[model samples]
Target: MFQLGKTIVSEDILEKEFVCNLSACKGACCVDGDAGAPLTKEETKILEQIFPKVKPFLRPEGIAAIEAQGTWRVGTDQDLETPLIDEKDCAYVIFDGSTALCGIEQAYNQGVLDWKKPVSCHLYPIRVKDFTEFAAVNYDRWDICDDACSLGKELQVPVYQFVKEALIRRFGEDWFSELETVAAQYQKSPRRR
Candidate 1:
C-alpha cells in the first residue's frame, strides 16, 4: 500500500487490469451484489432531493421500493446505502431489457438531475473506507468481474487508468495528477511486475 494524501492506496489498483465488459456482465455488479450500492452521507441527502426528478426514469418496482424504503437505508455495516428491492437488486436499478442500469444515472444523462449515481458505484473495484485519520482505498476482486479483467488485459488498461474520471471525482485533480506521477515512477522501477 502507498499513501496518496491521507488515503492508503492498494498496489492491486495499479497492478491489476479491469475494464467493465458490460456486454458479458450485463451490469451484474448492480444486481448481483449481496447489498445495495454504498453511499456517502452527502449522497443520501442528494438521493432524497433527486428522487422526485429521477423517479420518472425508473421502473415501477424501483419507484415502489424507493417509496417503501425511502431513498437510502443504513447498511449492515452501519454505512449508508441504496435500498434493495426484495433484497435482490438496488432500488434504483432500471433495466434495458436484461441489462441493469442506474435510474439516477439515466436521469443525469438526460439532464434531469445534476448528480450522477453514487461515487461508490462509479468507482467500482476500488472500495474506499473512510476513517478519522485517513481513508483506505483498495481493490475489490470479485468473480463477477472476471470478464472485465480479461477485457482490460486485452486492451492493456490498468485499473487506475480505467477508473480515471471516478478517481478524480472522488479525490481532486491535483491528487489524481500526483497519483499519475506516482504511477509513472512505479512503472519505471523493476518492482512493477
Candidate 2:
C-alpha cells in the first residue's frame, strides 16, 4: 500500500485496468451488490434533500421503495448505504431499457440537484473504508465487472486513470497528481506484472 497524506491506496489501484463496459455489464454493479452503494454521513442528508428533485427521474417502483424505507439505511455491516428494493436493487436505481442507471445522477445531469450520486457509486471498483485516522482505498474485484476488466486492458487504462475524476473529487488535485507521478514511476520499475 502507498500512503498519500492520510489515505492508504492499494497497488491494484495502479496495476488493475478497469473501464466500465456498461453495454457488456448492463450496469449490473448498481443492481447486483448485496448492499446499496456506500454513503457518507453527509450523503444521507443530501439524498433526503435531493430525493424531491430526483423523484421525477425515478421509476414509480423506486419512488415507492424510497417512501416505504428512508432515503438511506444501515446495511448488514452497519455501513450507511442507499436503501434497496426487495433487498436487492438500489431504491434510487432506474433502468434505461436493459441498463440500470442512477436516478440521482440523471437529475444531477439535468442540473436539478447540486450533488451528483454518492462518491462510492461514482468511484466504482474503488471502495473506500474510512477509519478514525485514515481511509483505506482498494480495488473491488467482482465477477460482474469482467467485461470492464477486459475492456480496460484492451484500452490500456489503469484503474486510477479510469476513475480519475472520481478520485480527484474524493481526494484532491494535488493528491491525484502525486498518485500519477507514483503510477508513472511504478509502471517503469518492472517489479509487478
Candidate 3:
C-alpha cells in the first residue's frame, strides 16, 4: 500500500482492472449482497430529504421496505446502511426488466433529485474504511464482478482509472493528481508485475 494524503491506497487498485458489465451480471451487487449499501451519516439525511422525490422511481417493494425500515439503518457493526427489501435487495433498488438498478440514481438522472445515489454505490469495487487519522482505500473483489474484471482486462482499464471519478469524489482532485503521479512512477519501476 501507498499513502496519498490521508488515505492509504492498496496497489491492487493500480494492478487490477474492473469495468462493470451490467448486462452480464444483471446488477447482482445491489441484489445479492447480504447487507445493504453502505451509507454515510450525511447520506442518511440526504435519503430522508430526497425520499419524496425519489419514491416514484422505486419499485413498490422497495418503497414498502423503506417505509417500514426508514431510509437507512444501523447495521450490527454500527455502520449506517440502506435498508434492505426482505433482507435481500437494497430498499432503493429498482428493476429495469430483470436487472437491478439504484432508484436514487434514476431520480437524479431524471432531474427529480440533485444527489446521485450514495457515494458507496458510486464507488463499487473500491471499499473505503475510515479511521480516526486516515482511510484505507482498497479494491473489492467479488465473484459477482468476475465479468466486470474480464471486461476491464479486455478494455485495458486499470481499477484506479475505471473508478477515477469516484476516487476524485471521495478524495479531492489534488489527491487524485498525486495518485496519478504515483501510478506513473510505479509503472516505470520494476516493482510492477
Candidate 4:
C-alpha cells in the first residue's frame, strides 16, 4: 500500500482502466460546476488569453458557469460549490439524440484555440490528481463507460510524463522536485487495500 500523509491507498484499485465516453455520460464533471478543480493563477492567465479566441464555440452557459466558480486549485473541494449549468448534463455537450459532441474539441481542431488548455479538458474520463499520493479518478463510478471514452484504449501515453510536465509548467522545477519525492515513494510501494 502507498501512504499519503497517513492515508493508505491501493494502487491496484485502478491498475487497468479506460477513458470515458461523453456520449453516454451526463458530463457531470465538466458541467456540474464543481469548484475543487480550480485552475492556478498561471492557468487562469493562460485561459483568459486563450478563451477569447474560442469564445464563440463555448456555450454561453458554460462560460458563465466557469466565471461564477472563480479560480480553484487541484485536489481541493473549493470548486464544487459552483452551480451546475443544466442540472441535466454538461452545457458544452451538444446531443443530437445520439452521440455527444464536444464544442471545445471541435473549436480546437478548427484552429480556433489560443493557449494550451489544461489536460483535464482534453483528457476527460482520466483524471490525474496530485494529492498526498497520485491517483486517477474513477470515472466508472459516475456511469461513464463507453468505448470512445476510454483514454487508455485510444492512446498509450505516459501519464507520469504528462503530470510531470504539467506540474513543472504550473509550479516550476522546485515543486516538481517535491513531487518526485512522493512519486518515488509510490513507485517503490504502490498502494494496496
Quote the lDDT for 191 in model 4: 53
Q: Which stretches of candidate 3 lie over 4 Å from their true place?
A: none
TM-score per model over all chains: 0.98, 0.97, 0.98, 0.49
Provide the lowest-lDDT 10-residue window in model 4.
73-82
How well is each residue in 84-146 modelled by candidate 1, as lDDT tens digits? 999989999988989989999999999998887899999998999999999999999999999
The stretch of ten residues in a row with the least summed lDDT in candidate 2 is 184-193
Off by over 4 Å in 4: 1-14, 22-38, 63-76, 79-98, 114-116, 131-141, 146-193
TM-score, structure 4 vs. true? 0.49
lDDT of 4 by residue, 1-193 (tens): 4443423433432343444445555454554443323344465555556655655775677667556643222334543222235443344444345555555455767878644445555444334454554543322233444443356446632233334454355446874565457655555663522
Residue 42's lDDT within candidate 4 is 61
Candidate 1 C-alpha error for residue 3, in Å: 0.5
- What lDDT tens digits, residue by residue, belong to model 2 across residues 1-193? 9999999999999999999999999999878979989999999998888888999998888888899988999989999999888988899889999999999999888888878799999999999999999999999999999999999999999999999999999999999999999998898886865
Each candidate's number of clashing pairs is 0, 0, 0, 16
lDDT of each: 0.91, 0.92, 0.92, 0.46
Error of 1 at 178 (Å): 0.6
Residue-level lDDT for 81 in candidate 2: 94
Error of 1 at 131 (Å): 0.7
